[model samples]
Target chain A: MSMPEGRMDEQTIAMRVAREFQDGMIVNLGGGIPSLACNFVAEGREVFFHTENGALGYGGTASLEEADWDLFNASFQPVTPLPGMSFFSHDEAFAMIRGGHIDISVLGAFEVSEKGDLANWAIGNMKDYNGDVVAWIKTGRFPPAIGGAMDLAAGAKRIIVAMTHTTRDGSPKVVKKCKYEITARKCVSLIVTDMAVIEVTSEGLVLKEVAPGLTPDDIQAVTEPKLIVADDLKEVEL
Target chain B: MNKVVASAREALADIFDGAVILCGGFGCVGGMPSTLLRALSELQVKNLTLVGNAPALGLEAQKTAARTMQVPESYADGSLLLKNGQVRKLIASVPAMAIYRLQEPFPIVKALQEGQDIEIELVPQGTLAERIRAARAGIPAFYTGTGTGTLLEKDKEVRQIDGRPYLLEYALKADFALIWAYQADRYGNLIYKGTSRTFNATMAGAAAVTVAEVGGVVEPGELDPEIIVTPGMYVDRVVVRQGETG
Candidate 1:
């Protein structure tokens, strides 16, 4: 299949994601794929970004000369604070989320249902020496804190999920149902995968568009769940 | 502080309608504010904004992994608040699957299926602490080294130094903070057992009004200063649990 313009790499995806940004929208970019959107934001656009860890004016890379050990994000990454940004208590960050001040939250999801349910922080079983049933978590938490995914999904009016359409095994990511646990119920608003862009609507997985050369039939055939193709759907262009 | 609640029936006396509160816990390891959660149920305040790490679940499922597909469990804490019919508006970080599932969230997905309003704010563990510290210290805000090129970028006044986007998460101080601790002196110097220190330490100092519930209330100076995690100056009141609550 031919690749779509500005969709060939993560940078392209980052650029495309930036297009969806509305001026003055308060948004949160999750780790990994979601973070890519920061670089592509249009100049003079007033998008206020809040890192859950703390810093309203935090921005771009850590400079060897200007780096402050205390000023960084959740991943211990260096941050640059923009003008007019403010900080509050950690709970205030959650308050900002819980208070309905945020307009959009761009997060990464592991499994997205055809119905748009998102499972971003559930733990599977891990094998111990005895192979006893234990919570398998990325952060070593059993009965882990469901953390902020639920709050972000519930609080934000617009939730955009960015992840591959399927796992490495070539299975369809836009599935009929998820194999992992579900954190938020049908909380996904948009699904941007490597192969296609899907919108989870009441009508089901509406095929927004597939990359160039990849037909709706091709996407559907690879998909385990049934898919709906948009009439007169064209290739996803940059 | 005692005026906040007189009994289980009126546990939510201090909480006004539409108040934003913080629920402190670490997957049941640390001292969680049970009294406050109980109060939420007693008041039955609906359409409220809330934040925490995980939904309070029954002990039965604490060790059980969720089966494939979507399943939303009753939030044990919310259940208590809901029992009183006070929580009309609610927001949290995770539903049931947020307890285990990552890619797909259950509570949010179910809400999405019906178009429910769900708001989630994700925070790193350590950065959360530092921000809380900044609040208690009365600093307008401080900087953390987490969530730069990631989700934390939103709402942050950013400083791009090395081709990375490091966002700001403002310090969070709420109207009321209810936290759990292992012990506290009459003067309010509190101590926690094990990892219970997670969010409680910050909550102790950050809240406008912080009432600490402890397993044991001892006399001041009974404990060593080195062992005391929260100084009495930060704590407003202390209520000791008759028995081990956890």
Candidate 2:
């Protein structure tokens, strides 16, 4: 398999995820790639942005000069509340999620299995680690955050995972089965990566679309599990 | 009868050493009782157990470690309290993200790393909220499937509900709850502004005494009943915004 000349950027992944959102839908954006989707929401589309921090109908990031410390998104970064936005308590916020009021939730993942099992929480137990000590000390054992991702995964009507195709060491993230602790089993519906767009189905992982300038073989070489190619495979549209 | 206090210092006067406090906030922003935290820092009480979202943004630790970045104003809720070494234990969800690790670890994580006296018990965000809500609602314990196969489920009772596993969580009641609101009346009824209502509303009545710091305080009849999110019965005292008239 040859290396592809073109790879989708973070903005492109966000744009692709943004395309899945529809008008008037209550969309929850997790940190990282999902959070970037806020900037790409289609103009004139009435997608209500819900922050797990107990707010709905909020706008995008605020300018530094205009930053109101009280107005922020779930990422703990400052945000601007749009007109007619409402606030609730954390209890009520999760109630809205568990009650199925949230139409869709976009989250970042570390590993997604063929069965759509998510293992983004803590990478396998750190006690078994035999890696560099200083690097381990700097990186720490557990991922620094897992705020409300599990609740969102269990509750959202639909879950879209956004992540890079591989780790920094070029290891595959899409695997036969997640070796880490599973956050939710068989919960992911769609995945938008920097390399390709894939769908998690009951049958197995299906190749939906490849990034521009990349061939199916390039993606297949990195993907640990066998990917079933869609009959109408095409380039991912932004 | 005016239940209004003059300042956050007076509002938190009864807080003793080792007292458990339920704080209300989302991140460094949104619904934090900023004044109360400042007062708590000045009071210098030790061994306090704080329950909240991100009590502090943990930015100062980063600034000290990096020496390159400027530390922003610690306007968030419990930054002062932690900076002053007040917290003994913290029951919170994820306090900070991966970005905070770039320079210095978040205060809580740093404390845990250094083997300090501080302890942290991580809770799922929803379960934490529901536990507090259950206390306010007079519910002793409830079952949820949130932490079922995770490390959080250790020692927690797991029951099968409709063949699905659900972990049992008990109510979380504190000695005092410090929260912020957009507006409050002399009767202590509160109305919160956009995004600032995060954990403030749920924690209102979950403690033995609930103190509210509001942007403004009005007469009883001034606030619309329909818009009041927390009733006066739940709030023990209300303090108008410090250094400003409402």
Report clashes for each candidate as comma-separated counts. 126, 0
* Candidate 2 ranges with C-alpha deviation above 4 Å: A1-4, A81-84, A123-143, B61-76, B243-246
How do the residues B60-172 of candidate 1 rate in per-residue lDDT, one tens digit apiece? 33324322211223223543443343433333433333324343333333332344443434455444555666677777765543444333445677776475334455676
Error of 1 at A83 (Å): 0.9
Candidate 1, A69-141: lDDT as tens digits? 3344433344556778764434556666655777778877767788787766544322331322112222234
In DockQ terms, which candidate is top?
A: 2
- Highest-lDDT candidate: 2
lDDT of 1 at B195: 35
Number of the predicted model whose TM-score against the real structure is largest = 2
Instruction: Judge candidate 1 against the unseen true structure and give its global Cα lDDT, from 0 to 1.
Output: 0.57
| iRMSD for each candidate structure, in the order shown | 14.0, 4.9
